[model samples]
Target: MGYSEEKLIEEKVFKDPVHRYVHVRDRVIWDLIGTKEFQRLRRIKQLGTTYLTFHGAEHSRFNHSLGVYEITRRIVDNAFASRPEWNEGERLLSLCAALLHDLGHGPFSHSFEKVFDLDHEDFTREIILGDTEVNQVLSRVAQDFPKKVAEVIEKTYENKLVISLISSQIDADRMDYLQRDAYFTGVSYGHFDMERILRVMRPREDQVVIKQSGMHAVEDYIMSRYQMYWQVYFHPVTRSAEVILTKILHRAKHLHEQNYTFKHKPHHFYSIFEDRMTLEDYLKLDEAVFLYYFQIWEEEEDEILSDLCRRFNNRNLFKYVEFDPAKEYKKLAKLSMLFEQAGLDPEYYLVVDSSSDLPYDFYRPGEEEERLPIHLLKKNGEIRELSRESDIVDAISGKRRTDHKLYFPSDFLEKEKARPEIEQIAQILELNLDNGTI
Candidate 1:
């Protein structure tokens, strides 16, 4: 039998918290899961730096990846199998795309990506198409199979139905992560009637639509996503930790550029620091590797680098206050100067971060990062965009909300407040009255 068609003598079942059981029967899937590249996900956390905030949020990407695969499998084999719109030939391709979509996420995910200008999606394509174990295993099915898998994950596959199953507004990836993250973190915000939504899904030529009967369940799902973003994902404490983490990366790179010698050489980070990190170099990185360097850098000679590393390791995160970027520009400038006078480097110690979200948006052409809107299928077989049919959805649709915060080392500012030289700046910030939290 061909590798793609080969089934295991017995189905392999993974007992999962979110999906209950991830059943694997195809030899191709079983082999791909055993590949070293996929195994590396076990060492990478699903929610980076979130464990510090939600202590139970220690689940790894390997767990979330398998949940995503299982959700896609259910949609393909259970919901859409007999539907005329779903091509049976695309089943394996969809499963592969769902499982490998997050294959290239680095340690600390977004924070690391921001500092180094790395795109995990770019690395994801490289891993599937380059000379790697994942590619080798995929090549066994067919010479072009690996490219097909990569294209599906990249949202460039010709099969629009397959792309929509993974990338659309309410797809398998988000479905898995929302419930999975909520389960691990013990939060109720990500909960919704997923089973009902899955049952009512109808496949279309270009996208997936929900049966009219399932509108309320879909509404619940949307609200769950909106709440999860503000309550759990964008928790202020989590952002503070991320701010410290980003500074550590920035300080290390700056030191590297200045020819600063390290007491403990950063062998794993040298390629990344040079911006020439190869596939091999990237594959060698995981959270454990980063923690090792951070542990040793605590004693490094560079005060900024060592201080930032110490703060991250010890959980001494910076405190923040509400900031308005448009109106508070002068206040921010004054704070930066005061931070410097108080023996804190404004670049490393004073920072501003913003978080924003669009609860739901309808299709808008010619806009950057255009997203496919959700559609609901009527009883007469006609389809309507979700917002048009549901009053609840229309209320918040197309609205964007944003928040900004100014972060600084309140401990240093408190000490400097009593000093005559920097007292004026400290009072301007009201550190003495509020103890630095707002």
Candidate 2:
């Protein structure tokens, strides 16, 4: 038998703060949401370490996942369900792909991925195609349905139109996360006309495009993304917290490699340290699982691991100063030496982090893995890339901006002001100790 097209006798609704009501009609989606693997998302924070900086960012990935699914549902069911340019057959595929896109994200996904050299997308594919309950449900739809959903997430699907709906510049994932993150962070940067943008979205032969009339809304979205990237996503304090997180994981991994006994071993992280994270082991980790270890590790005999865990758990994050790696290598080296002299290990105490993004870009042919540019569909049945037509988009299109910051435990140096090296290091780093200014 083919995949079931069964619809629920009545829809289920999740009262979301961002989307208001996330409606679910298809039984497959409902069952997928109820699966153990999908339920695991509720335990992972949407913004990871951002909550330490912005107390309001305590929302979970499950919340953002539902919001993404709801937005994609609106686009497919409302805007294109009756349109000939869109394939009605791919509706479930798009919805499922959107819902499960972030399923593989571990606790503190970015730092975890970096320290362990892992990809959440790879885990996402594994979960959907493996022996998990999610795979079982998808296989019932037809043995290949899960693969279709996975491909959409992977951006390797033959249907470019479907891939763009979830992965493009102005796709449902960004549309949901921007508004949802803004609402949770209590910031104004991520707010834009998602509703109007959705209303203007049209599926083309190759991809989804917005009507030219909605160009202003699209411009606002691009600008909103730019603002949020700097203000919220790239906040230095948040990065400071992330630095500590990355260091904590690295320290734990190093200690494990040396066979140094951890007073409280990270049983959940064993597979990760060995660079062989099975799907079962991956599913066992979440923020709570990490936090439990952090709390316990705070009492460990190792000063570095204990201090970092206490900092992360107690919100005693490192302080950061503006840094340019190309020009500030000497400054970083000098600070490292000072930290070592001050009895702080420079390997764990001193760190540099960078955040960068291109606000928008039009497609460049033959560019491997470049973004698919935003398009504006004209009334005359013509198509134009956004930067070619919009002044606002053109202004920043193809421009990549990067910001770097150096993170260090200020308290470590401040505790002993009698040491002249601390002052010299502070002077070189150009920090305002009075106000913790960079």
Candidate 3:
């Protein structure tokens, strides 16, 4: 007997601030969410340490997973309903792909990746295809259904419509996160007319395109992305938290390598430290487990590990100021020496965080890693690349922006005795203590 496409006896809705209501009708998605793995998302923060900067961003991946599913449902309904271009057979596949996209993301995903040399995307694929509850549910649909969903995530699905629904230049994932993050962070910068964008979206051969009249709407999205990148995504204070978290992981791993015995074993981190994490172990981890370890590690005999853990837990994020990377290396070295003299381990205390991103891009012929350029369908049925038709997108397209900030603990230096030396270090870093300039 084949797996039946059954709807829940009673429809379920998750009250989401961004999407308002995330509706679940299908039994499979409901079952998957109820599984232990999906519930773990509640413990994993959606924004990592951004919660330290934007307190309301304490929402979890469970919140975001539902948002993604809601966005995917809306997009599929709006764009693919009664349309010949979209295969109705792929609707469930698209929703499943969206819901499970971030399932493999670890606690503090990017920082964990940097310290452990791991890729969340690879882990995401593994989770969907491995012996997970997700894999079992998907396999029940068809023996190869799990592979199809995984392929959609990997952008190699034979069904381009399925692929586009989850991962186009302006797809459901970006659409949801922009509005959801903006709402949670109370930042209006990420807002755009989502209904307008969805209304104009049209699926076509192997991709999705917008109607020509929606050009301005697309421009709004591009600009919103630009502002969000600077104002939220790359905020220095958020990066400061990241710096502290990274150093914490580094110190712990270093101690582990030196055969040091932790007063409390960081068992959840064992797979990460050894670089052989199975999907099962990975699924067991989330931010709460990490936070639990952090709370316990605050009392460890290791000064560096304990301090870094305390700093992360208490939101004592490092202070940051803009730096001229080309000319600042020498001065930075002297500051490191000063930190060492103060009995602070410069290796764990001083950090330079540099981040760069291109919020929007235009397609270039023969480019190796070109973005799937957004297209607008004309009345005459011709398709035009977004930047070619919209000046706003053209202005920012392919323009890469970079930001660098040097981070340190200003509070530690604010004490009366440390004030003079702290001022000296601040001056060397070209920081404006009075104005909070960075």
The C-alpha lDDT values of all candidates are 0.86, 0.86, 0.81
Model 1 whole-model lDDT (C-alpha atoms): 0.86
Query: In model 1, which regions exceed 4 Å deviation?
Result: 356-369, 433-438
Instruction: State residue 283's C-alpha deviation in candidate 1, in Å.
Output: 0.5
Off by over 4 Å in 2: 1-3, 356-369, 432-438
Q: How accurate is candidate 3 locally (lDDT)?
A: 0.81
Q: Tens digits of per-residue lDDT for model 2 on 24-93? A: 9899999999999999999999998889888899999899999989999999999898899998989889
Q: Could you estimate the TM-score for every candidate?
A: 0.95, 0.95, 0.92
Q: Rank the candidates by TM-score, best first.
A: 1, 2, 3
- Where does candidate 1 clash, by residue pair? none
Per-residue accuracy of model 1 over 109-190 as CA lDDT, tens digit each? 8889889988899989999999988999899989999999999999999988899888888899889888998999999888
lDDT of 2 at 155: 94
lDDT ranking, high to low: 1, 2, 3
